[model samples]
Target: MPTHFIKLKPSAVDEYKAIHAAVWPGVLAALERAHIVDYSINHYPPLQLLIATMKYVGDDYDADMKKVAEDPETQKWWAATDGMQESFATGATGSGKDIPWWTEVEEVFRFEGTS
Candidate 1:
């Protein structure tokens, strides 16, 4: 399971929210096909930040990500969504490359519910 923190431009907040309100079915299917589960996206209005959390059930994160990226529908979705995001600062991600968007944050703490 992994959680990611990302930021959105203030001007694009409304458009981003509106789009996610009715996400395309193919996008959802792509995520599931990538072995991604428990996906959630949250917004902070004041900061215009979006935090995404997901459990990756697959063994290979990179490979699953590549599959997701290669999906035509997913690419179309990103084409519409990418412009609303802000890129991470250089050296902000482990990839050693400037991430096009959504900077990854190191989780500092977590509390699990006792079931």
Candidate 2:
């Protein structure tokens, strides 16, 4: 699982939510095909931050991401979304790679409740 944070433009919050509320079926299928599961996004209106969490059930992360990126529907989704986000403040990942958007946050701790 991974958690990421990105800032939304001050004015794009509502539109962003609206658009995601009914994400295109193709986009959902594309994510599934790329082995992304349990994907979710949340918003903090006060800070205008969008938080996303997802599990990648694949051995090759770069390959899975490349598969998602090359999907036509995902490309269209990005075209619609690329302008709604604030410019990257945290530029690189823990791997020292400069990613385009969404800074990955390190998880310090977690608790899975006993059943």
Candidate 3:
């Protein structure tokens, strides 16, 4: 499972929430095809940030991501959503690696309940 932290532009927060409120079926299908399960996106109004958590069951993360990226419907969805996101640079030293849209976050702690 991977958790991603991303920030939304102040102006785009509302629209971003609205769009996800009724996610497109094609987009959902694409995610399933990519072996992305238990995906959830949470919004923090005060910070205007979005936290996305998902479980990746696929063996090849990069390949699955590429497959999802190549999907026409997914591309269309991103076209509408990407503009609403804020991009992040790798680090303070001006690293060439730019996090695309969602910045990856390292999970510090986790707790599971036993039934």
Candidate 4:
């Protein structure tokens, strides 16, 4: 299992929190089906910067991402929230591009807890 990290800043904390409060069920299920686990998000208060972490068990990162991107429901979900993001990079590349608001980070270490 490998941990993945990403950074981004949503337009507003309240708006971002409200959206995640009720994440689309289909998107959640799709992530699970794609072998993504331990998904978590942390925020820097006032700054509104968000750090997302998830564990990926798949061997091919690009392939797994492609599967998630091809999902119809997920595409529709992105369409709804695309405008609410403040991308770190320029150009209107939409969501989940190599250059987007959320930038991927290399993981160094991780420890699993037993529930």
Candidate 5:
């Protein structure tokens, strides 16, 4: 299994919080079916930033992303909330990427005190 991490700047804290408060049911189901496990998002209030992590356990990551993208309900859900996001330079406008609202990062540590 490999872990992916990403970060995004929220258009507004309340707007971001509201959508996450009730993630759409269809999207949630798609996430599990696509082998996305242990997903989570953390926030930095002062910076209005969000960091997300998802674990994937498969050889073909692109296949999983395709499954997620192909779901009709997931598409609808994204359409409704797309405007609430603010993209960083790397984000594609109205085009889906590995992470919808965030940019990926290279992992530098696993356990804080392992060394």
Candidate 6:
């Protein structure tokens, strides 16, 4: 499971929720095809924060992610949502490149004791 954190523009909270309430069918299908499952996003109104988590089950993580990124519908969806978010990049990613959108959160502990 990978968890990501991003901030939503305060003005975009309601609209963002409304949009996700009925995500485009094509986008959903593309995500499923990419083997991304158990996905969920939560919002914190007080801080305008959006936290998302998903399990990637595919054997090739990069390839599957690239497949998702290449999906036309996903690209369109990003177009609509990009303006509603604020990137959390601090240029500290090990890749030495700033993450354009959500920032991956390192998991220090899990209560279940196992994945």
> Who wins the TM-score comparison?
6
Prediction-by-prediction clash tally: 0, 0, 0, 0, 0, 0
Stretches of model 6 off by over 4 angstroms after superposition:
90-98, 113-115
The parts of candidate 2 lying over 4 Å away from their true place are: 89-98
Model 4 / residue 22 / CA error / Å? 1.3
Residue-level lDDT tens digits of model 1 in 1-115:
6766667889898899899999999999989999998899998878777888898899998888888878889888888887787655554432212353566678889888898
Candidate 1 wrongly placed segments (more than 4 Å): 91-100
lDDT of 2 at 105: 90
| lDDT-better candidate, 2 vs 6 | 6
Q: Candidate 5: which stretches are off by over 4 Å? A: 1-11, 95-101, 112-115
Error of 3 at 66 (Å): 1.3
Model 2 lDDT per residue over 1-115, tens place: 8888888998887889899999999989988987887899988889888899998898887788777778888888887886788655555332112465677799999887998
The residue-level lDDT of candidate 4 at 42 comes to: 78
Worst 10 residues of 1 by lDDT: 91-100
79, model 2: CA deviation in Å? 0.6
What is the alpha-carbon lDDT of model 1 when measured against the actual structure?
0.78
Tens-digit lDDT track of model 6 for 8-60: 99888889989999999998998899898879999888888899999889899
Query: In candidate 5, what are the lDDT values of residues 62-99, reduced to their tens digit?
Result: 88878888898888886775566555636456425554
TM-score of each: 0.84, 0.86, 0.83, 0.75, 0.75, 0.86
Relative to the true structure, candidate 1 has a C-alpha RMSD (angstroms) of: 3.3
RMSD of each predicted structure: 3.3, 3.6, 3.9, 3.2, 3.7, 3.9
- Using lDDT as the measure, the top candidate is 6
Question: In candidate 4, how many clashes are counted?
Answer: 0
Q: With candidate 3 superimposed using the best TM-score fit, by how many Å does residue 56's alpha carbon deviate from the native?
A: 1.3
| lDDT of model number 4 | 0.69
Return the TM-score for candidate 6, rounded to 2 decimals: 0.86
Give the per-residue lDDT of model 4 (tens digit) for 1-115.
4332333444455776788899999999878877887688777655555667777887786788778888887888777766655555556367655565465566677666796
Alpha-carbon lDDT, every model: 0.78, 0.80, 0.78, 0.69, 0.68, 0.81
